[model samples]
Target chain A: MTDSSQVYVREVGPRDGLQHEQTWLDTADKLNWIEQLGEAGLTYIEITSFVSPSWIPALADADEVARTLKKSPGVTYAALVPNRKGLERALLANIDEVAIFLSASETHNQKNINADTESALARLSRVAEEARQSGKAVRGYLSMAFGCPYEGKVEVDEVERLAERLFEMGVTELSLGDTIGIAGPKQIEAVISRLGRMIPLERLALHPHNTYGTGLANIYAAFQLGIRRFDGSTGGIGGCPYARGASGNVATEDLVYLMQTLGAKTGNDLVRLTSSAQWIEKRLGRPLPSSQLQLSKEEGRCL
Target chain B: MTDSSQVYVREVGPRDGLQHEQTWLDTADKLNWIEQLGEAGLTYIEITSFVSPSWIPALADADEVARTLKKSPGVTYAALVPNRKGLERALLANIDEVAIFLSASETHNQKNINADTESALARLSRVAEEARQSGKAVRGYLSMAFGCPYEGKVEVDEVERLAERLFEMGVTELSLGDTIGIAGPKQIEAVISRLGRMIPLERLALHPHNTYGTGLANIYAAFQLGIRRFDGSTGGIGGCPYARGASGNVATEDLVYLMQTLGAKTGNDLVRLTSSAQWIEKRLGRPLPSSQLQLSKEEGRCL
Candidate 1:
């Protein structure tokens, strides 16, 4: 087993965060933020999503964002691809990895993607095969794996079934998302315990939102259960699509601060990350929802 | 060992929270909120502090608050008393329990109370004896037990020694406070492991601030280590007196939501507690910092 002392942090601000913003960030600005994230020693940066712009207008320049960003040699630049068409676009943009997402609940999957759970899985299976053949890494996101705002209390068996299928489809990693941020410590432990038995812990990642303020608690629980990789937005800019007016992804600064404080080797610089978060928040003309960023900005110090 | 499935929550919003607010809540309103908290099934509430108005003008009406609030049969109402004078005031107000506080670090103690650590301990020792003789349950708070804002990392041995001293001084419970909220999982585990050897876990409680957003994480860590009791503010209205521009104590709504989600029987109604939080926030004219309150208000649903 890999030691829990090291954590892999994946930054998903550009795709998950900006997509929820009402004001559109220019492609150049998105690329600038991506470059800043890479410079801060983030090994994985989900640059943008190649989904239809009609579905998420804020990320209309996804192709431009993926093509224009400066990629660090050590950083893996990723993009979210909703379908085979999006996968083709990601390949054209020279993305290092493509993430495909489907919610575990039938209602959530239908509401989010306009497809049922089985249809979404079949579609993702084909996309994963195509991406693998292109020599690109594939990541599967099981959104609402913990609970769904629409359905509520997704079962662990459902998550295991979906995750096993994704793994079989050649996904290098499976990101279990608490899409609405309703998961607590015991719920996280139960889900991870069941999933860990069927999937390798190294290939399992946690993607928790902070809507109900249980994000860090759930993350800590998962870490104790041997989950090492985590996905976070730089400034908690994203939103839970199902739970309107709730928070976005857990803040990258908060996650990095917690991991680093616990002696977990993240290889990310807290000061530099905070600076980047401040820079982006300034551009957005609104404060990010990150508690650590707010504290660092107010105190003029970093973790 | 006690079952980890049960959690005892201590609500300190009236004392810890209101004292930090710039706008004062009327004594009647404070009593109303306390009544609501008790109605929601909270068994313990720290009603008010017996500090002088010169120090914390917000709680100047503490006597009225403690005397006017309706004490439920099953609920234990507590008060914070800094010295023998404060302890006398608490007894005069008919408080069931009196809490005495001193920081684990000399600098924090000096800054917060105008006394060195040893002198503050000596003063608290006297107050603890008086309160115990009065047949009042006494709780000792060691502030900055996890880390200090000025001194930085506080040694665990220092915390253990202070906790041992407090226990020996007739304190029924010793609340270890992460006053600055800089503690992480490993640090919490290390401190709790060392403290658990000398003090019974039942006599130990966690009082963590959310300054760096690690409050819930620390609470979960302590809970896993068999520390069942936790202290929280209703609306996250309290501030770390030492850590400038930081968040207050972990929100009671957030903590209750987490414990309930984990199947820990707190016996508190989250909906009723959130209603009280909303009522207080409305009076303050600004939103409280509790993320759970925000979600509950936005979603119009409580855990």
Candidate 2:
């Protein structure tokens, strides 16, 4: 089992969460939110994505957001770069790390990036090389690692094959995405047990969605299997466009609460994290799906 | 670990869930819902409570609901009884089982039942005796077993003591409730490990809320510790009136989904359960907090 004392959480709310929102937040608001998340003790925050503005008008001002935000000391700011073009913009913005993503399922890869798996890997490899040449770290995201929407059940062998390819392309860490939120603890165990043989457990992170309310259970199972890193949104924002009716990423506040109760230190302040989530909830003009945020509001507690 | 092959789920939606709803459902609708639950493969359902109508107007027609609903063979119908008076009403209705409850925390007990732990236990012991004499099984619920809102951090020793007292009073089973939804996996492990020593694991159950999003994780932890019985509400209805900001009990649909995914047979039909939840959600004129229900609705699938 992994050491239960310390855990690393990467906040992907600003980028992944806001991308799916119909209401576009102002660039300044995004920067302020990112700064507040850092102040709340998040060591790593994915501020925005470098995809084409035409594709995601919500995060169109990513360059401005990355370049103008006040970067907190001791915090690593990252951004999602889809290709070499996105990587060049990330390099200009001096992002601390660049995240590239593809899908384990062939159908999902075709639908998500409009390219097959091999073609998408070829593009991400070029981006990884260029980002590394600029002395920046590269993180890979393997979507549908557990299940896919178009496809029924994704094979463990397919996930391992794609993960190994990403690692071979110099990707330092891979965050396995349960894009459809269809996984449970047993599925997590089955997949992680297979992957752990060929990949270092420490280099793996879990990105689970709470669509069917099994997100935290899956995380707990992975933790038991010695997986440490996790990714979550501040207010449980973000849903895959392809996965119909899917909830956002597992809420970061909820994840931190579980980790802390499990005796794992996440270096996050619960009160401040709740405050950040509430602040963003107001900005979004709609309630975010964080259970802790809802409870705090119901209790009328400042936290 | 408990036999991971089979699990017993007790549905508390009609009783605990409706008692907290602001809008009163018609007695006919309640009967219809209860029948549907049985048809959906729930073998144990808490149909109503025998408390005074003034205390819970939503369940004012408890006798009518209990007496008029069609009882399925092999399905046990239960109701919550506060004292000898309530048990008298329950016995008149010919309910199959009677459940009595108190709190692990002193303040919560006073606020919830208008009696301290000692007085509440004295009253419930009499209720249990009368119910058993009338040929009805008795189930005890210990609320705030994890933490209390009025008094934070309830002692596990206190839970053990109260549980032992109830078992001594001839309670065949005791369901430990996380009334405020403040527990995580570690707290579950801690509490169950202690309670398991003094009590038979099979006679213990977990009734968790989803307020802080740790409900399923807590259930998973308890299941790992050999807990086979769980209490849930269909569509995740019922929040604590005393515990401010607390969400409803863990959703039955979500629970069954988790158990099935973990290779445990719940004997509940997912499609029928989702339909029941959706039907109630419509009658309630609001969405229930079930993740699986939400996902099914989002997908626009019949299930």
The two-chain DockQ for each candidate, comma-separated, is 0.45, 0.48
Error of 1 at A123 (Å): 2.0
Evaluating just chain A, the predictions reach TM-scores of 0.95, 0.95
Candidate 1 lDDT tens digits, B152-221: 9898888988888888899989898887678887898999899888888899999988877788888888
Q: How do the residues A94-208 of candidate 2 rate in per-residue lDDT, one tens digit apiece?
A: 9999999998999878877899999999999999999999999999999889988788899999999999999998988999998778899989999999999989988999999
Q: What is the lDDT for B71 in model 2?
A: 95
Angstrom error at residue B83, model 1: 1.3
lDDT accuracy of residue A102 in candidate 2: 93
TM-score of chain B of 1: 0.95
* Predicted candidate 1 versus true structure: per-residue lDDT over A1-303, tens digit per residue: 566698999999988888878766887888888888988899999988898999889888988887877778999999999998999899999999999988899987787778998888889889999899999999989888888878777988989988998899999999998877878888999999999887889999999988888888889999888899999999787864333345678989999999987779999988888888888888888656777776765634311
For candidate 2, the lDDT comes to: 0.88
Spell out the clash pairs found in candidate 2.
none
